[model samples]
Target: MPKQIRIGTGAGYSGDRIVPAVKLAEFGDLDYLVFECLAERTIALAQQRKLSDPSKGYDPLLEKRMRKILGPCAENKTRIITNMGAANPEAAYAKVVELIEEMDLAHQKVGLVTGDDILEYLEAEDFPLSKGREKILANRDKIISANAYLGAEPIIRLLKEKADIIITGRSCDSSLFLAPMMFGFEMKEDEIERIGKGIAVAHLMECGAQVTGGYFADPGYKDVSGLADLGFPIAEVNVNGDAVITKLSDSGGEVSLRTVKEQLLYEVHDPANYITADGIADFTKIRLEEIGKNRVKVSGGGGKTQPNELKVSIGFNNGFIGEAQISYGGEGAEKRAKLAAQILMERLRILNLKFEGLRFDFIGAGSLWPGGSPSHIPKEIRLRVVGRTKTRHDAEGLCNEVEALYTNGPAGGGGVSRKVKENIAIVSSFIPREKVIPQTKTLEVENGSG
Candidate 1:
């Protein structure tokens, strides 16, 4: 018999449901509940939020989530880890401390991982940007955010110090789970194969419900029951790096080999040479077995050392996208929808909206596979038009034209909704790992912000 640890995936994305996390904290008996919330788009939006107001940059749902799960997590002694800090970990730290005091929960220690924001340093270094980002570098002022993908070392340090909840900014998703494994198993960095196994496990669990059947439901092919009450995944791992991916038995959804395999390959470019901040995992060598109804045993994950350079996600002000959708329900809905699209295109030229690019999508039609002729005529069709413009004003004008179409023409154009969104472009660049130093700040409620 060897030592084992349970780590639960709380969130898969920034706007993921909270009830699943509450379930994990209350009944999953997890030693750690990690929320992987930072994506390139989310990190960019958070940076914009910080730019608007210095005190308001972290994840919008951070307060709501902390309020709900903090109680159960404290009661069950489940440590929480999240990269909800996004653009500002220090401010996130302050806010969490405030919550701790207001809630008056016994959860005392809170740790913040910082020094990931390498904007100034990146600018000074002028490192070679990835994927034509060097071209975008000419418009340097438009760059909204630049954060390095930090590894598990800082988090491991925080865990050893007994931090109740750790907040991070733009950390590697798998690194969030890797830190706990490395700490619990007392695994060293030089231990290559074990580290790779840990990375493989984290990759599968980081997406939360994806490994449990949230995104695997098909009508008749792969019908997954109790989707309304889908449960998040929990990893039971041993010192040998062997893991069992499962969900609460009483909870909804299935965790068979299909679900596990689907998630394992999700967003993975190279199964054989999957790269991460922790180790280069060889997912090809990984093996999965369905030992039970809702349990899949995972083992035989191989790996190599971490890359010398760390990939940095950079977000910049791309443009504004104005989108408007209107529905048509009748015998000849498809015909009317196409006509509406034509009318909008003509109106755009008349108004001189100055769109950089424009696209028309006819929902319930061939929007997904454009240029393909579809003979099946849909009774109800929704016309969706989106245009990209240089300025927000022009973007608003584009949407306004769609709204105007309702009263002018396109009879039966109902449920017209229009909105303008800031278009943020995310790019990646690499920097020497040694240049980006990750520091941790542990604070307590009674200490009044340390």
Candidate 2:
């Protein structure tokens, strides 16, 4: 079709900044703008919200983000792709439709990819816990959500159907970029090397600003300018599956070899084999060339056959975490904080409260480097006590003990703060490829008319 395609990364995570995405939509001249907004535990939290309100499981910022970029994206004919649907793709699709109607962008068409959720099909016995292969049935009552990581097949199908916007739940992050390449270049499933090259491009761009010097900046050794106005990444991929990583010319950020290398190694367990739902990418052979001031050409990635099974992330209620913090200042702050911690322990013991676990940290005195000698004692230190418990009552007791330290034992104990929250734990398991049946749905408006 076209000689090359430009894909811009909009959002890297669920809570990423919105301004960069808006900028991309307005001026990037991208063929596709992808938002990778789902994380391992985000869907689980969204599921909890869905249980409370049937129509609100998707990313909370979906509406705001869509409202900001939808009009510009539709005007520019830059198709949108996002996994922001989170736990509810249908509801997300409906919301997008409403936004389109409200914005009167009837020229745009929306599509949703579904069936990644397999909570109903999963039997606790069939899929054991990922950590120890423990039977999932043990925590059946607490399980909140289970979603499989779909690949690019369904997205490719949607593109073939000419869907302008595609929403999904838990699709592979790289697949968002790969789908367009596969569709635009007419690449077949068996094209392993080409697919791998595409995957390499996706992995590099998936984290948005990470490739553009956001996370890779170190003050003295490696430095990036204009951090506050950093631009998201854009990949100009060719039919051959090679790509050049760059950003908007007027944007602020550096796309250098150091930044690209750091991002390439991020979250990669093995350089030779980076696994995903679609296929296993061999990044060992990937080569990067600094083609311009803010452009790097990438090629030489290889791919193996797709995995026989797909990994699924399962979320369950792990219990509750109770935490409280109190600050001590003026000479001997460390001693006072330690005394406060001791008093908390003694109080918990007196109350005969049995917590699953407990931890005490002295913020100003080597909490991060535990047991390491501090060069000097600070004038101020904060004592933070946290505990995990099976029930809310037990958790509340832990927090209350820390709060009571102000009046009962410690001197100059101020800035007392306490919080209790339900802990959503995650586990992973795999299922046969045949088990997941991904389908697509389309919604369109005719010539700015609903």
Candidate 3:
């Protein structure tokens, strides 16, 4: 029999349900449990938090997640890999140590992958933002974070060192899984085709429950059962990088050919040339077969060698978005909602409040679909007014106008609510691979000998 490793996804995003992760850690007999929780703006928000309090920049749920799954992982002898470090891997590393000491799992070793933060690199070099030659020097003050999408080489090094728990900041999401596959299979860095095959498996498993029918639900056309207790995904990958995408037999979600195929094409712009930190994978040639119920065998992927330049995500302050909503019901609700929106717009105009951006949506009255779909007129409707501005004062000025509609402008404009939120924008640029030198260090466990 060919050697293989069973890897499971615990949490897909920062706010994913913890119960599924606990289930995955406990019941998904596995070699590694990966939690991919960093979105593009997530690390930027974390960087903001870090600026306010140096020790508080990691994921808020990191402590809770570690407490829940650490013991199960130790019991199953399965290692943990995650990018929950967000903007602060060292602080996250310290927190994990504190948890292990408290839980008395002193033999468990944790490691950190560093050097993803490339703000210093950007400052040293005047790089453009994305495709445009617009230099970043003008908006340098607004930048919160600049992190490179690191590949699996650093992670593979940590796995070789036998770190039971791995923490990283802004790693390429799929690289979290590819690192283990490469290490477990002893696949070298120069093996581009083999690496591409591994990338195919990594991309499928990166989104956690996404591959297990969580996002594959359509009411009549594509119904997925038991979504209330939807189970996460587990990929069984062999030496040749062939994989079987599956879930627990008793788990809620299904892993049919449809789900696997959907996730393969998810976010893939060019099916023949999907780019990543590791290499460019070709999804056009991937073969998918439903060998058994909820078990799909995936293989046959091709690709080009890894890119010479690595992409870096730049997070910056992008002003504020202010929003307010009011509802109207019973008799001509759509008209009432539209009239209320009109009132807010005219009111803001009279107040001489200028906004960077503004929008008025008459929800339940063809807001989602423009030019109007022929659905029955809603018995009730909601009017939402949103504005984006540079200052919080302007943002609040935009929301206050909507609240005034309750009494000053429209009748039955009840259930009024408003909010103002800071918007963190994300942009990308590229840097040479040689510039992003990742380093890994193992955290020492405390009091192991009994």
Candidate 4:
């Protein structure tokens, strides 16, 4: 008889801060533990790792945690997958080997999937990282990061090798667990519709209790309950591929209708046509419920066909940026910040540099206050100017030049200079699955390696 495979994920503030997810494997009958980390900036950091060090990229802290978790999982025989591989899977894989050895786990095979960091490799292939290549703006040399988000198929393939843990580079968040489920249940590709629906299910529940009551209305706690030990969500997916989102019995956070709705709206723009590499899921069909305090069940979640294209994220040389700040202590400080930015913009035009972009913002005065029109007023205001240039030096120059405004131009204002970092390249494309490979190869590592 086939075992009923269970899937769970660690949830956090932004999908990256999933400290609670580290404990998810301790729950009931978990066949696979999937950790989804990385966003636009993460890809850029991974690419930089490759350029700076060929054997760098994956997060070391995550590796350490995996080592600790694997001890118990290896005892129970659970497989794991994560995109923590970043730019350099070889280095990451070696670290995993070190951890496994420290735990003295026997017969633990760790599989690494690479080829996700193709930024440098693409340049070598004369690919030059063009924008809209496969419909994604492949940010060329200016790219801060480049990572290929792999789907679940490759992971499923790794499971066939009897690997205890699978490490990957930028695999889809849903693919982390869905791949294992597919492998365990022997799901097929022809069932693309079902596969797409499963991906949607994973997305809905990936943030753990977030879909339940964490983000929902919890008048009792004001927001989420048990703020300290909030539990992540798990899916008990059946052979038919249907999933139930739940958490450990003694975990934190609440799974309520409000939380589920918040999770549903996460990064979802088109409710009718949300596509993943696996399949397409319809947002309209999602039926959520508060089955228990920390349990939210989903049903009737199936949708239309997915587009042939895949969304690619690309980062490129957008250029360097410089920022300066000024605080308005006097009344009408909010008005001052806005005027200061406008004045600085004019000054730059006179200087003929004009800056690539410039922005003035208000802080503390509730610039973030909801509603197009602010309903309430606050005390004090901060006026800040940020400008970006094509080059780092140019940006620095602007920062220095702006500070001069305090003495020569604006009143009751002071300025400071700060450096900024490159975000990431988000490119969308439609590449046939055949064109991409999961890089399901492993490198042998010595005992107690770095």
Off by over 4 Å in 4: 1-3, 11-15, 27-29, 118-147, 212-222, 303-307, 335-343, 346-354, 364-377, 401-417, 442-450
Number of the candidate with higher lDDT, 1 or 3? 1
Give candidate 1 regions above 4 Å deviation.
127-133, 371-375, 446-450
Clashing pairs in 2: none
What candidate 3 gets wrong by more than 4 Å, as runs, is: 128-130, 133-135, 448-450
In model 2, state the lDDT of residue 229.
88
Worst 10 residues of 3 by lDDT: 128-137
Point out the higher-scoring one by TM-score: 1 or 4.
1
Which digits, one per residue and each the tens of the lDDT, describe model 1 over residues 120-161? 886887755445566657878888888999999999999999
What do the candidate models score in CA lDDT, each in turn?
0.89, 0.89, 0.88, 0.65
lDDT by residue for model 3 (122-221), tens = 7777763344326455677888899999999999999999999999998999899999999998988778778888899889998888999888899999
For 358-432, candidate 2 gives per-residue lDDT tens digits of: 999998787788666377877999888899888988889998888888789778999989999999998888878
Give the distance in Å from residue 277's predicted Cα in candidate 3 to where it truly belongs: 0.7
Better of 3 and 4 by lDDT: 3
TM-score of each: 0.96, 0.96, 0.97, 0.84
User: Quick one: how many clashes does candidate 1 have?
Assistant: 0
- Clashes (backbone N, CA, C under 3 Å), per candidate, total 0, 0, 0, 30
Per-prediction RMSD in angstroms? 2.2, 1.8, 1.6, 4.0
